[model samples]
Target chain A: MKYAYYPGCSLESSAKEYDLSIRACCQYAGVDLIEVPDWICCGASSAHATSHLLSIALPAKTLVQTEKMGLHQIIAPCIACLTRLKVADMEMEEHGDLKKDVETVLESTYKGSVRVRNILDVFLNDVGLEKIEKTVTTPLTGLKVACYYGCLLTRPPHIAQFDDVENPHSMDDLMRAIGAETVDWSFKTDCCGVSMSLAETDVALELTNKVLEGARDAGADCVAVACPLCQSNLDLRQKAIGNKFGVFYDMPILYFSQLMGLAFGATTTDVGLEKVIVNPFPVLGAI
Target chain B: MRNKLEEAKNIMKVAVKEDTTAFAKEIQRKCGQDVLTCYQCRKCTMGCPMAFRMETKVNELMRAIQLGLRDEVLSADTMWWCVSCETCATRCPQGIEIVEVMDVLRETAIKEDYYIPVESIEAFHKVFLRSVEAYGRLYEMGFAMDLNLMLKDPLKDADLGPVMMAKGKLKLRPHKVKDLKSVKKLFENVRKLEESRV
Candidate 1:
């Protein structure tokens, strides 16, 4: 299978591991990822707030680009990008005025012909869990992971429509396919306080701590996520949270794709495992 | 306690003064959902895990926004209360992205120099930017202490002292992030861009 891939900004820098691991996984799965050309930032948490038209236009620009490639489904790995792009598609489809307004701003036409699917949505929905399960060569037995569905994925399920809003099974099903155990916890859909990380550390710390404690309490050895922002909050925020809350939790948070690569018998280097904020060595040692 | 009727009246007065209607209007323009749809359903409050300790009412926040009660809406502690769970955003009948609305309000508050648990939050943001600037990645331990100090809540350190002692995890000596100059340079560039944008 081939996809028009949108890795987003974080994938280029802080979360390069996510970019690498997903690429490795696609290669293993015989999936082709065509990088979107001349793509601009999706405005993430910024553009959407300032200019209404820019929010839709930014993603629509990419959609127009994808249309040029003749690809209908684009595989966006970042949760924020996936949310913004897919939500744009959703809003454009629902509000005709919005489409006209956005088109006027971009001086281009968008027919909403393309669809944005995050990695998890594409893998679990299009590729099939059975295909993933069949490829597990080194069964990641005994690795207990917390499945984290960052706020964007499931909320407004109609736009990000890949899983249940209250209880998502895509990541869990994917984790199981890779031979890992997923904890049954309610915080799976909890917020990582990503946007609030800067202005509201106290709140961000509390929320991040909740997910960590919830995962630990639920007997998860590590937390698994599909979003780089979620991984940043869960893994990178630990030290700051430790200082604010006075608790130390060196929890190893891994991208779901990394674990999948592990289960598929790929080495840590193949997936850029060394790049994560929280070291996965201890966990890898145990495994 | 202040009279509930008088308090509600006063709240309305302040809300109007803040032009919260404009704020809500801006959000509606962006999100395409009527901010007025939030009829104090409290589903957002019910779903908010951290609502137990917050000083503001999530339901009233919506009302403030709809009424264009700008001052009340911006100043109300509810702006700080969001954990960004998106639960309320998810549950809204109008499909409002409540979390995004909160973000917009926060940014607006900052732009207008209104009020925002800013001292604490700004400090934390600075710490994060420092880390990102230095390592091109977030370093938790250093950023955490810096943020705590910024909060001026010295007790944060005192509270952690015992826990750190118990776990043998506290490092008395802080480590400068590797390639500190490069990180400093990065932060300098980011600040320059941010300054230019502002």
Candidate 2:
């Protein structure tokens, strides 16, 4: 299967491992990812918070470019990017006036033809679970994983319209297909305090602490995530969370794709496993 | 009994109000979210993760919008604290999409040049957009540098720099898209449209 890949900003920077692992996993699953040429940022939280028009227009520009490339489906690994792109597409399809405004800003008509899918969706739905199971060279047996959906992935149900917003099970199913134990946790769709991590570190730390503590309480060996922001906050800020809360949590936060890559026999370096803040080698070695 | 009645009368004094539908109308015009649909249900507030940190809760903000309390809503730190988790929007029985409402309020606050209670969030937004405007994508190092400079704390997150570098996560240079001029033009067109709306 072939699809266009829009590896938003975080993939190339803070969440490079996500990009690496996602590509590796897709390749192993026999999926071809053609990167969108000269794709711009999706104008994430800042654009939406600042200007309503710009937020829609920003993603519209990229979607229009994808149409120009003649790709009908695109996989945006970052949950936030998928959310922004999907929302823009939905708005333009639903409102002709907004579509005209966006077309005017982008100087191109958005056909609303491109289907935006997150990586989790690409794996679970696009590539059948049975097919993925057949490709697993190393079954992650006995390794308990807390599958964190965070927000934006399946939220505001009308816009995302993916898995069950409250209790998403796609990631869990994907993990199970790879032979990993998926733990049932309450904070599956909780907020990770994303941009707040940069603005208000304290609040973001508190939210991240809750997610990490929840995973730990449920006896998860490590946390598996699908969003760049979730991985960044949960992985990078664990130290600060520990120092602030006077609790030691050495839990490793990993992208779901990385775990799949591991099961597909990809090396740690191949998937950028060493890039994580907390070392995951111990847990990976155990299984 | 007379004294208690007088005290109660003083506490219950009411004032005449002016028409305040303009705030709600403005929100509707901007994002098409109708705050009138909200029936004082606290579901949004209950589901909001940042409600505890907000000066005004999600339901309170909806009430402020309905009442056209422009000054009260604009000056409050609630909108800035919202992470746009969409939990409120997901749980809202009215289907008001409180997240979009918050976005509209934030845009209005910025347009009116209200005193932003959370300067850090405003600063972060500015730096983030500036980075994307210059380069097609966000330059992590440049963004951090610019944010630190704007916040006047160059060494704020300095400790994480080396660690990130070691992991090969920090990019020393930004990748500018080939058709950057088009991106610039898009920004200009949007800016012009925003100005025209105002």
Candidate 3:
């Protein structure tokens, strides 16, 4: 089970713990993650938001490199990265001039043959639930988690083509495999205003406040997320979000990969759990 | 791009040509999404999570495009506030790629000018792409600092620097891609292509 890995920018910095935990899970899952040699930034939320030419051309370079690496599929753990790469792949196949222009920009042809998959999709579909169930050495039986699937995880249907876009159960199913109770929540595919979090602080904070309030109302002990942006927005900004709203809900925004590591008998430090703003150790400790 | 984006920037600069559908036609030509086909179902606006913060809702903006309200549609803060949550796109009954339309609006805004009262995000993207062009990957600390300076709010997110560095997430130096020169050429080529299109 070897695959190319494009960590993207966030995973490399700010979301370092997410990168660590994901690599740790893949190691135990017996999956080999070959870092695509000199992978370029996929020009995520920025490129697509700014320039169509750059958006397609940027990810085209990454896809070309993945093919050169001889991997038919690549794993991009970040939801934004997954969307950008997948969208670029779709554009490469559907648009003739765009593809040609992209190739001309890079001085390379984009075959558009490479498939982009998120780690969760690989674990649930490729690795199967039974294997995951048996791999859980320390079952998190009592810990309740609200699985946060930010927008674009599986949507604009033709592109992501991953789990059910509206009520994504893929993360819940994975959480169940690790013996954790997945809480049903409304903000499953809600927008956390990730891009706005930096630009318009109040707008982003107020929007994130809704998700935080939703989870807090759902009676979950903590939140489990697949995307780094959600984790940081919900966790990293929890303090400011609370300060602005005059209500503080200390729900830990954990990486689904980190929770998987804990289920596999990994310690807090092993998955870099100490790095998150809202600590999950106390919540996990309660169990 | 000019009609929709430029109208909002400055009425004097935007010339509403004879064809009202010219803006719609330009959008379709640039990107495949069709705004003229929308019949005001409002499904896109209904599912939009950011509607609370948007001045013009998705459906309203779609109608604005259809009516050739170039300046009104282009100057809308709605596109900038969009998180690209795909909910609107996924739920649109007309099969209109609403998110793509927002992306198109943003790019058009850039082409016209970054004077849509959301220059901060524009600054971020510009600096972000510059970082990628320089190193093939985001130079987080450097980019954030540069973005702050560009936005003229240098003290913004100042506390996050040391906190991130403490967690070993913020790197003092950038992880430059091995083939940095080739990566830069891609950006240059794209810019040349963009400027030459019109």
Clashing pairs in 3: B4-B70
**Measured against the native two-chain assembly using Cα atoms, what DockQ does each of the candidate structures obtain, in the order listed?**
0.14, 0.76, 0.59
lDDT of 3 by residue, A13-113 (tens): 88998989989888888889999888889988789888888988888898999999889999999988888888889888888988899998999887777
Winner of 1 and 2 under lDDT: 2
- Tens digits of per-residue lDDT, candidate 3, B1-198, equal 878876676764454435678889889987888889999988888888788877888888888898788988889888987888888889888888888888899999878874686677777788888888888898988988898899889999887777777778788899998999898899889888877877
Candidate 2 vs 3: which has more DockQ? 2
Q: Give model 2's docking category.
A: medium
Off by over 4 Å in 3: B1-18
Of models 1 and 2, which has the larger TM-score?
2
**Candidate 2 lDDT tens digits, A202-284:** 98988999999999999999999999989988998888988999887999999999999999999999899999989999999
Per model, how many backbone clashes are there?
Answer: 9, 0, 1
The residue-by-residue lDDT of candidate 2 on B44-98, one tens digit each, is 8888899889888888888888888889899988999989999888888878878
Better of 2 and 3 by lDDT: 2
Best candidate (score: TM-score): 2
Rank candidates, DockQ, best first: 2, 3, 1
- Can you tell me which runs of candidate 1 are displaced by over 4 Å? B1-32, B35-39, B49-55, B65-71, B74-84, B93-198
Best DockQ among the predictions, by candidate number: 2
Give the candidates in order of lDDT, highest first. 2, 3, 1
Q: Write the per-residue lDDT of candidate 1 for residues A1-287, one digit (tens) a residue.
A: 87899876667655777888999899888789999874555656554433345456667767877988999889889888888898788878999987876665555678788877778877886778888888889888888888998787887666676679998988998988888888899798887777666445566777789888888889888899888878877876788877878887889989999999888878898777876667788877866
Cα RMSD to native, each candidate?
8.4, 3.1, 5.8
DockQ of 3: 0.59
